[model samples]
Structure formats: structure tokens, C-alpha cells
Target: MSTELLTYLFVGVTFTLYIGIAIWSRAGSTSEYYVAGKGIHPIANGMATGADWMSAASFISMAGIISFVGRDGAVYLMGWTGGYVLLAMCLAPYLRKFGKFTVPDFVGERYYSQIARVVAVICVIFISFTYVAGQMRGVGIVFSRYLEVDIVSGVLIGMGIVFFYAVLGGMKGITYTQVAQYCVMIFAFMVPAIYISMLITGNPIPQLGFGSEVTGTGMSVLEKLDGLSAELGFAQYTDGSKSTIDVFFITMALMVGTAGLPHVIVRFFTTPTVRDARKSAGFALLFIAILYTTAPAVASFARINLLNTVSEASYKELPKWFSNWENSGLIAWVDKNEDGKIQYTAGKSFAGKPSFTDERGESGERLINNAPTEGVNELYVDRDIMVLANPEIAGLPGWVIALIAAGGLAAALSTAAGLLLVISTSVSHDLLKQNLAPNISDKQELLAARIAAGAAIVIAGLFGIYPPGFVAQVVAFAFGLAAASFFPAILMGIFYKRMNREGAVSGMIAGLAFTFAYIVYFKFVNPADNNPEHWWFGVSPEGIGTLGMIINFSVSFVICHLTAPPPQHIQDLVEEIRVPSSNNAAAPVEGGQTANA
Candidate 1:
């Protein structure tokens, strides 16, 4: 069968499976909608968390960024994976023990303030929206390529599917759906890596293949990549360009951000016990590591294949994938100097290079300038297209390419479901049922959750149609916001008995304000001001969250010491969460109890 037909078959099958799972696991109550009735097995919840954590950024974008950036990309691998350890140890179990349906529920009860809960709801909404936008965009990219639809149409299709499943099943449907999604995404990601590895280095495992010598060239993969990078005027693959401090802080930011992410933390709440929550985190990390470890190998393989395939090739002689991507507007080439030979290098501009003229050809196609320039650079490749294009670039089988299409959609949709849940739960449970409409029935709340989820999907779809930035960059900003606003407050609430509502609320607001201001100023107001030299304390925008986190911790502690300590009963509630006793574990509730321990 043709690639298009194969893609349709595979993607169609996956969609059918997702819809079936959603229907099978349809939720009946608010508890079922919010926490899957708190009956998820540790292993199952772990797999679900893995799927939730590994969004499009991990599945579609990480390898692509790593392929071009090389060692610098290690931060993403380490930062994202390492944060799970913190979640498992410092946050997940305690939050799960608190037995609340939402992150803001814990914050509100823990701090004993409606203001604190509202603040948390705002933070969760902001972070979740920022993250979901990228997932929506990922869905669009996959659909645009595989289904041959425009991005807006692709986003709408995705929104429709997610709305059907997520609104119907809520957390229950999303969890089971994610379990299947994890399997599909992992298989799709691994197969191409293994195939490319065997083709390049005669090794089946991508990690091993990345270190092995090329089959014919007899040079190690890294050595060959370094040589090619030098030849092409790009940085060596083994070396990184970021400063040490920037790398340190960015990694720290991602680590804390991962732990603080409301969606990930909410997954632990689905587990039955605190011990299960901890165990689930371990299993989730293990599953995530499968793809995380394979990604670098895939990056190495893609870099090698791309350079070998494109370098010094004439425009007319280039492979079919070249023209395919070019037609998609992701890859561009101009025959500068009219030599007809393609030059693929860094820092090349399309301006003053080539332009389409008004004149028409015999076929009625617009005629463009074909004159070649003396410069040896004529191509521009968007990094985001690397992974999706990798299978084609390597001449993989049609079925394999189709599987990747399903995998990308799964990755994007699964995480989008998870984030939308956080958004909806925050609005319905935390904002409405808990604070505003305390007497609301469970049935009413369930309807509100569904409505909120549908609204969130529409907003997420709009963001996808007009993305604020690249997938990874927007996600990094979300992480920054999470790290600054949520991590410190949650951690302090669990670890420090003296922490009071006044301090916790103040810290969250300060952190959220500071991080949001910095990101907006650099990313939107003055993009030129994002350089290292201009950054406060030399911290890049990606790493600024670490500083914001510190500010939160410092400000909260200072204010806590200055003000009266938390009431004795609140301290007892803190002690109760710290201990893992099953007897003390509170029953999961919409409006959780005040600190009456």
C-alpha cells in the first residue's frame, strides 16, 4: 500500500482504539471523573503518568532538538527525568496522602485560605494552558503530514476527539487511554531508532549503535558526526554551546518544574495509597527512561543520516524526502550562484538568495530565479520537522512511517487530555464547587467539569492554530512558571510545619508574577533582549525559573518567620501528611476538610 493509505489505516486504528477505551471507561461520579475513583493500580497509574509526562515535546521535538544541538540537549534528558525522582520523594506521595482531587485543593486546605486556593488555581490554569497549546500544535503537525489536512483542520479534529473522550471519561477514561497511548508511542518511537541503528552500525539497539563504529566507514558515530559538523561549519556534536551556569539553572528549573506540574502530581492522586504513589513514580520514570535513553541515539543517527544524505548533493539529484519536505514549507533551498548544487549549512538566509517571479512557465507555474550565488549555503531546515521526517529520510518502510504518525498523535493527545483535566478540575472542583458554590451537587459539578474541559479544548485548539512559539520553547516557559509558582509552595507545605497561609500565598503570587514578567518581557516584548549579556545575573529565560523558585522560597520563609506561625491544628495536619499511616489518610473529597487534625 502507499504511504498515505498506510498512514490512514494505522492512525484510524489508533483513533478507534482510543475512542473504544474512552467509552469503556466512562466515568459516572465526580470521584470517577476527577481521580478515576482512586482505584488505579500502581503499575497502571505509573504507565499513565509516563504517558502524561511525555508530551509532544518529548515524543516529537526532543530528538529533533538533540539532533542539532548535540550535548546541549542533555539538559532536557536529565532535567525532565531527574525531576521524577523529586516528585517521587518530595511531592507525589505526600500530595496523594492528602487525598484531594486537585492540586489547588491541597494548597487551599493546607494553607487554610480561599485566597491561597484561588492563587493556585490561577497558576495551574496558566501552566496547563501553556503546556496544552504545544500538545495541540503537535497534534496538528502530525495530522497535517499524515492525513494531508491543514494545521487548523488537524487541530479541530484533535480537539473533537479529545473532547469526546476526555469529557465523557474524565480522569478515568484518560488514564486507561493513556496506558494504550504509552504503548503505541513507545513502539513507534523505538522501531525507527532500532531500524536506523541497524542500518548505520549493524546494531539493533540504538543506544549501543550510537557508540558503535559505522559499518563501512569504521569511525565511531560520534567521531563521524564531529567530522561532518566541522566540514559543514556547525558545532561539534559532542560539544555544547551553553554556558555552565545557564545549563545548571535550566536543568534545575526543568527538574523542579516537572515535580511541580499539577497534571503529573494529580496522576499520583489516582493511586490508592501513599506507598503506591511512590512506587508508581518509580515505574513511570522507568517507562519514561525507555524513550529518554533512546532519544539521544536517535538524534545521533538522524544527524549522521541527514548530513550524509544532503551534503554536496545537487538539487535535482536530492532524494524524494528533500522535495517532500520542501513542498511542505519545512525545508527550503535556493540554487544560489545558479550551480544547481544544494548547499546545506548554518546561518543561511532566504532573503536576497532567490525570489519567485511573476512570469509563468509552459505549465503555468510561476517561474523563479535560478541564478546561483557564490556562497555555499542554500538550505534552511526547521528542527521541529526532524523526527517526523527522519523515517522518510532514511527510506524506512511505509508501514513504519505510518506507525510514527499514530505515535505522534498519541503522544500529543494523551498529554493534552491530562492537561485539560487539570484545567477543568481546577475550574469545576476548586473554583466553583469548593470556593464559590459549596452546596453544588456532584452531578452539577460533573457537568461543569465536562463543560470546562470542552472550553479548554477550544482554547487549546486556538493556541495551536496560532502558536505563541515553538513547541519546546513554549513548554519550557510553562515549566518555568510551574517551578516558580507551585513547587516551592507545595514542598514547603509538606516539609515545614511553620509555613502559614500568609507566607504560602505571598510566595506563590511573588513567584508567578516574577516568572511571568520575565518570560513576557524577553519572549514577547523584546526578543532581542533575551541574550545572555542582558539577562539578570546571566540567567537565560529558560533558567530564570530557578531564580524565581529561590525567590519564592526565600520570600515565603522570611514572611513566615515574621508573621505568627501556623495554628497548632494546621501543624498537626502537616504531620499527618508527612507520615504514611493508612488510618490518617483522608478520604478523597471535592471540598477537602480544613486542617482539623
Candidate 2:
């Protein structure tokens, strides 16, 4: 069958599987809708969390970023995984023990105020919506490229899938579906990476293969990569050219932001016990590492493959994938020097320089059709295409390509569903049911939840269509918001007895406002592109989340010292959340009655 037909078949089968799963598991009560009835296995929950956590950025853009950034890119690998460590060690157990339906319950009760709960709800909505928009965009991009559909159509299709299961199954449906998604995404990511590694270096482990000697080349992989990069004026693959302080702060920001995210924290609530929460966290990291470790290898291999292919080729002779991507505008090439050879020079110059010399030519700077590009030039291949394009770049079979398409969509859609669930539950359970209309029936509340979820999906899709520049940048802001606003309040509520309502509410506002203002000022108002020399203390807007988080902790602590102590009842609530008893885990809030009769 043709590639086009095969793509349709693959997408069709994947959609059927998702629909089948949704039908098999329909959430009945609020408990099932919220936390999978608190009966999920540790391994299963871990898989689900992995699928939920690994967004399009992780599946599609991660390796490509690593490929271009080299050692400097290790920040993502370390920052992302390290956050899980913090989660497993410091946060997950207590939150799981709290046993609440939503994170706002903990904030409200622990801080002894409904106002704190509202703040928590706002934070959750902000973080989840911003992150979900990226996932929707990712889904659309993958669909447009592989399925030959427009991004708008792709987004609508994704919206339909997310709407069905997220509304029907809630967390219960998402948990199981994500488990299956994890398997598909991971296997699809690793297979092509391993094959390409073997083809290039005679090694199976892509991580080690990145540093090992290249086949038929006496030089080590890093050495070869470094040499190739140098020839093109790019940074060495193994060198650290970035300012150490900036990288440190950026990595730290990402780690703390990961730990602070409400959706990620709520995953722990689905487990049966504190022990399960801990174990699930470890398992989630292990599953995540399977891809994280291999991602670097894929990036390195693809970088080399891309350069070799496009370096000397003419436009007409380019492969189908190249032409297809170019037409989509995700990839662009400009022959600046007009030497008829595409150049891969690394300097600040936007002009094209010859990337690879044509072995067939003697004196002319003319690029050869033998390679991927026609003339000496610079090509802009989007970082997001690395994972999806890997199989095609390596000359894999059509099935593998099809599998990749499904896998990319799976990764994007799974995360989108999870985030949307969080947004809906926050509105329905926390805001509407708890505060607005406490007497609403469960059926009516669920209907409200469905409406909330559907609305969030449309807004998220629109944002994706007009995405802000830099996928990771927006993601970092999402994380920063979580860390600054949610992490401090939640952590203090659990670990500090002195944390009072006033302190918690004030602290959340401080954190949220500070983080938002800093990002807006640097990202939009003054803007980095327009004012390159005006960064605050040399910190990029991406790293401001860390600063915002510190400000939150400081304000929370200072306010707690000056304010009255928490009421005796709130102290007991803290103790309850910390304890490992079944009763404590039964209801997330002490007075909030169960929605189910």
C-alpha cells in the first residue's frame, strides 16, 4: 500500500482503540470521575502518569532541541526527571494521604479558608490550560504532517476524541487510556532510534552510541560530532558554551516547576495509599527515563543524518519528506551566498554557508544533488519533527512510519485529555459545587463539568493555532506558574503547622502575580527580541519561574511568621494529611461531603 493509505489505516486503528477503551470504561460516580475510584495499581498509574506527563514537546521536540543544543540541552533531561524525584520524595505522599478530589481542597482546608481554595483553583486552571494548548498544537502539527490534513481539521479531530473520553470517563477513563498510550509512544520512539543507532555506530544503546565510535570512522562519536559542528561553525557537541549560571537556574526552574504542577501532583491522588504514591512516582520516572535516555541518541543521529542528507543536494532532488515538510512551512531553506550549495555555518550570520562540501566537485562551491540540499545554504528544520521524522529519515518501513504517526498523536492527545480533565474537575468540583452551588445534584454537577471541559478544549485549540514562539518557552512559563503559586502553598499546608489562611492566600497571590508580571514584562512588554541587553540579572524569562518560586516561599514564610497561627482544626487537618491511615485518605476535605450518595 502507498504511504498515504497506510497513514490513514494507522490513524483509523488508533482512533478505534481509543473509542473502544472509552466505551469499555465509563465513569459512574464522582469518585471514579475524579480519581479512578482510588483503586489503580501502582505500575498502571505510573504508566498513565508517564503518558499524561510526556507532552508533544517531550515526544516531538525534545530530541530535536537536544540535537541542536548538544550538552547544553541536558538541562531538559535533568530538569524534567529531577522534578519527579522531588515529587516522589517531598510532595506525592502527603497529597495522596490527603485524599481530596482536587488540589484546592488541600489548600482551602490546610489554610483554613475558602479563599485559599479559590486561589488554588485559579492557579490550577491557569497552569493546565496553558500546558494543554501546547498539546493541542502538537496534535494538530502531527496530523497535518502525517495525515495530509490541515492543522485546524487535525485539532478538531483531536478535540472530539478528548471531549468524548474526558467527559465520560474523567480521571478513571484517562488513567487506563494513558497506560496504553505510554506503551505505544515509548515503543514507537525507541524502535527507530535503535535501528538508526545500529546503522550508524554498530551499537544498540542509543545513549552510549552517542559517545561511541562511529562505524567506519576511527573517531569517537562525540569527537566526530564536535569536528563536524566546528566545520560548520556550530558549538561543540560536548562543550559548554552557555553561561553556567543561566543553565543552572533554567534547569532548577524546570525541576521545581515540574514538582509544583497540579495535574502531576493529582496523579498521586489516584493511588490507593501513600506507599503506592511513592512507588508510582519511581515507576513513572523509570518509564520516563526509557525515553529521556534514548532521546539524546535519536537527536544526535538525526542531526547527523539531516546534515548529510541536505548538505549537498539540490532542491528538485530532495526526498519526498523534505519537500512535504517544506511545503508545510515547518522547514525552510535560503541560499544566502547564492553559491548553489547549502551551508550549515553556526555563527550569528543569517546568510547561508556551505554545510558540507560536494565530494564530486573540485573547485565550484556548487551543492550536489547527491545529498539532501541543492545549494550551499541554511535550512530551518523544526525541532518538533525530530521524533516523527526519525523513521522516514532512516529509511524504515511504512508500518514503522505509521506507528510513529500514531505514537505522536497518542502522546499529544493523552496529555491534552489529562489537562482538560484537571481544568473541568477544578471548575465543577471545586469552584461550582464547593463554593457557587453547594446543593447542586451530582448529575447536574457532572453536566456542568462536561460543559467546562468542552469549553476549555475550544479555548485551548484556539491558543494552539496562534502559538507563541518557542514551544519550550511557553511550557516553562506554565511550570513557573505552578511552582510559584501552587507549590509553595501546598507544601506549606502539608509541612508547616503555622501556615494560616491569610498567609496561604497572600502567598499564592504574591507568587502568582510576581511570576505572571515577570513573564509578561520580559516576554511581552520589554521583550527579549527587541531588548536583548535588558535581561534582569541575566535571567531569561524562561528562568524567572525559579525567581518567582523563591519569592513565593519567602512571602509565605514571612507572612506566616507575622500572622496568627492556624486554628486548632486546621492543625489537625495537617496532621491528618501527613498520617498514612485509610480514613485520612478517604476524603480529601474534612467537611466536604461525598458527592455520591
Candidate 3:
């Protein structure tokens, strides 16, 4: 079959499988909807968590960013992976032992204040929505290319499909679906990596292939890339351009942010025991490393392929993949010198990303409204397209290319569902039933959760259509928000029995406000001044969360000293969680409720 037909078949089949799983395993009660009835096995939960943790940002955008930014992109890999370890070690099992339905549940009861719960709910919504937006954008990118639809239409299709599964099945449906998604996503990712590795270096393993010598060239992949990049006025593939402090801060932000992310944290709550949470976390890391380890190799292969085919080449004679992406408005050529040859050198082809016009140029390339800049570079390629376009760029099999489309959708939709569930849980369970209504029945709350999820899907779809930045960059901001707001509060709540409601609430508000304002100022208000020269302490917006996290920890500590300690019962509960004894695990909270209840 043709690549086009194969793509449709793969996508259609996967969508059907997902919807079928969701319908068959749909939730029937609040317990099922919120925490999968706390019955998921460790290995399965780990696989599901892997799928949930690796969003569109991981599967689609990470490799793309690495391909473009080269060595500097190591921050994302380190931060996200290290953050998962922080979560698994410091947070997951304890939160599971705390026996709360959501992050807000833990916050409210631990602080002994409804107001704190409300604050946590606000943080959850902000963090989840910001993160979900990237997943939606990833969905739109995959659909726009393989499905031949505009981004708006692709987002609409994704929104509809996600709504059916997420709103209907809730956590129960999502958990099992994610297991399948993990399998599909990993297989899809590795297949192409293996193919390209064998084709380029006579090695089947992508990780090794990354460092192996190219088949004909005596130089290794990085050496060849360095030479080509030097010729094109770009930095070496192995050398980083970002300052050391900035890399440190960004890495710290991502690590702590992963620990604090509401959606990923909640996955542990679905497991049956504290030990199960730990086991699942381990399993997830193993599964996630499959793709994470291969990403550098995939990136190297793609960068080499891209440069070998297009740099300073004639536009008309260039491969079909170039025009295919050009027509999709992700890849544009200006023919600036009027020499009929494409220039793919360092620096921007224009002032910003291309603003494509409805009309095409004399050579049938997408016309951009942005005026061409004064440079040898005449190409503008969206970094997000690197992974999706990689298979075609390397002339991989039709089925392999089609499989990537499936994998991209699986990765994106899986995380979107998880994030949406967090939003729903926060609104229906935390905001309404926990604080406001307190008297609503389980059925009413379930209905509210579904309604909240449906509304969140629409809002998230809008963000996908009009994303603030590239997928990885937008996700980094979400991580920054999470790092600033939730990580400190949760850490102190667990470790410090003296932590008071006043301190926790104040710290969260201060940290979130500071980080959010910083990101908004640089990324939105004064994008022109977003360079390192104008950054505070040489920290970019992506890394500002580390500073915000310090502020949170400090503020909470000072406020705790100034205020009375948490009540005796709350202190006992904290001691009980830290003891880690299953026999005495059920610590009592206010209203005679057991922590494990």
C-alpha cells in the first residue's frame, strides 16, 4: 500500500482501539473515575504512568529540539528524567500513603484548611492546562501533516476523540488505554530509530549508532555534523551555546517540576499500596528510558539527513519531503538571492517564524508575509517537524512513516487525557465537592467531573490551535510553574510537621505569582527582550522556576516560624506517613477520617 493509505489505516485502527478500550472500561463511580478504584497492578500502572509522563513533548518535540539545538538540549533530557526520580523517591509513595484522591486533597487535609485546598486546585488547573496545551499542539502537528488538514481542524478532531474517551471512561478508562499507548508509542519510536541507525551506520541500536561512524565517511556522526555546521555558520553539534548557570537552572526547574506535576503524581494514587506506587515508578522509568536514550541518536540522524539533502541545494530538485512540509506551512523557502537555490544556513531566514500567506510563489512554495532578512539563510523550518518528518527525510518504509503518525497521536492523546483528568478532578472534587458543596452525592460529583473535563477539552483545544510557542518551549514553562508552586509546598508538608496552613498557602501564592509573572514578561510582554542579556542573573524564563522554588522554600520556612505549628493531630499524621509502616499506615485526619480512607 501507499504511504498515504498506510497512514490512514494505522491512524484509523489505533483510534478505534483507543475508543473501544475507553467504552469497554468506562468508569461507573467516583472512585473509579478519580483513582481507578485503587486496583491497578504495579507493572501495569508503571506502563500507564510511562505513557502519561511521556507526552507529546517527549515523543514529538524532545527529539526535534535536540536536533535543532544540539548539545544544549540535554537540559530537557536531564531535567525530565531526574524530575521523575525525585517524584518516585520523595513524593509518590508518601502521597499514595496519604490516601488522597488528588493533590488538592493531600494539601487541604495536611494543612487543615479548605482555603489551602482551593489554592492547590488553582495551581493544578494552571499547571495542567499549560501542560495540556502542548499535547494538543502536538496532536495538531501530526494531523496537519499526515491527515492533510489545517491545524485548527486537526485540533478539532483530536478534541472530539479525546472527549469521548476522557469524559466517558475517566481514570479507569484512561489507565488501561495508556498501557496500550505506551506499547504503541515505544514500538513506533524505536522502529524508525533502528531503521535509520542500520541505514546510516550499519548498527541496529540507535544509542550506539549516534556515536558510530557514518557508513562511507570516516568521521563519526557528531564530527561530520560539526564540520557541516561550521561551514553553515552554526554552532558545533557537541558544543552548547547556553551559559552554565542557565543550563543548571533549567535542569533544576524541570526536575522539581516533574515531581510536582499533578497528573503524574496522581497516577501513583491509582495503585493499591505504597509499595505498588514505588514499583510502578520504577517500571515507568525503564519504559521511558527506551525513548529517552534513543532520542539523541534519532536527533543526530535527522540533522545529518536534513543538512545533506537541503543545504544550499536547488529548490526544484530537492526531495519530496521538503515540499511536503513546505506546503504544510512548517517549512518555507524564500529564494532570497533569486538564484533558484535554497539556502539553509545559520540564523533566522526572517525576523521571526514564517507568516504564510494563502498564495503560493512562482516556484509553488508557500508564500510568507514576513519580509526576508539580510542573510545567506533562505529557509525557515519549524523545529517541531523534525521527528515527524524524519522518516520521510531518510526514505524509510511507508509503514514505518505511518507507524510514527500513530505513535505521535498515542503519545499526545495519552497525556492530554491524563492532564484533562487532573483538571476535572480539581474542579469537581477539589473546588466544588470538597470545599463548596461538601454535601453533594457521589453521582452529582461524577457528573460535575465529566462536565468539567468536557469544558477543559474545549479550552485546551483552543490553546493547541493558538500555541504560545513550540511544543517543548511551551511545556518548559508549565514545568516552571509546577516547580515554583507545588514542589516546595508538598515537600514541606510531608517532611516538616511544623508546616502551617498559613505558610503553605502563602508560599504557593508567592512562588506561583513570581514565576508566572517572569514567564509572562519575557515570553509574552517583551519577547524582543527575551535574550540572556536582559535575563535576571542570566536565567531564562524556562529556568526562572528554580529561583521561584527557592523563594517558596524560604517563604514557607519563615512563615512557619512566625505562625503556630500545625495542630497535634496533623503532626501525628506527618510522623505516621514518614514511618512507612503498612500496619499503622492509616493516619487519622479531621472529622475522624483515616488518611488511607
| Lowest lDDT 10-residue stretch of candidate 3 | 357-366
Q: Rank the candidates by lDDT, best first.
A: 3, 1, 2
Candidate 2 lDDT for residue 111:
74
Which regions of candidate 3 deviate over 4 angstroms?
A: 351-370, 582-585
Candidate 2 has a TM-score of: 0.92
Task: Give one digit per residue, the lDDT tens place, for model 3 in 402-488.
Answer: 999999999999999999999999999999998889899999999999999999999999999999999999999999999999999
For candidate 2, give the lDDT.
0.79
lDDT of each: 0.87, 0.79, 0.91
Q: Report the lDDT tens digits of candidate 1 across residue range 1-597.
A: 999999999999999999999999999999999999988998999899999999999998888889989999888888888888888888887788777889999899889889999999999999999999889989888887778787889999999999999999999999999999999999999999999999999999998998899999979999999999989888899999899999998899999999899999999989877778878988998999899989998988888889998878876676777766654455666655567676677654443322432212111111134454445677767677788889999999999999999999999999999999999999999999988999999999999999999999999999899988878777888998999999999999989999999899989999989999998898899998889889988888888899999999999999999999987778887887787655534533223452211
RMSD of each: 3.2, 5.1, 1.9
lDDT of 1 at 243: 92
Q: Report RMSD for candidate 1.
A: 3.2
Name the better of 1 and 3 by lDDT: 3
TM-scores for all candidates? Answer: 0.94, 0.92, 0.97
Q: Which scores better on TM-score, 1 or 3?
A: 3
Cα deviation at 55, candidate 3, in Å, is 0.6
In candidate 1, which residue pairs get closer than 3 Å at backbone N, Cα or C atoms, i.e. clash? Answer: 336-372, 336-373, 337-372, 337-373, 338-371, 338-372
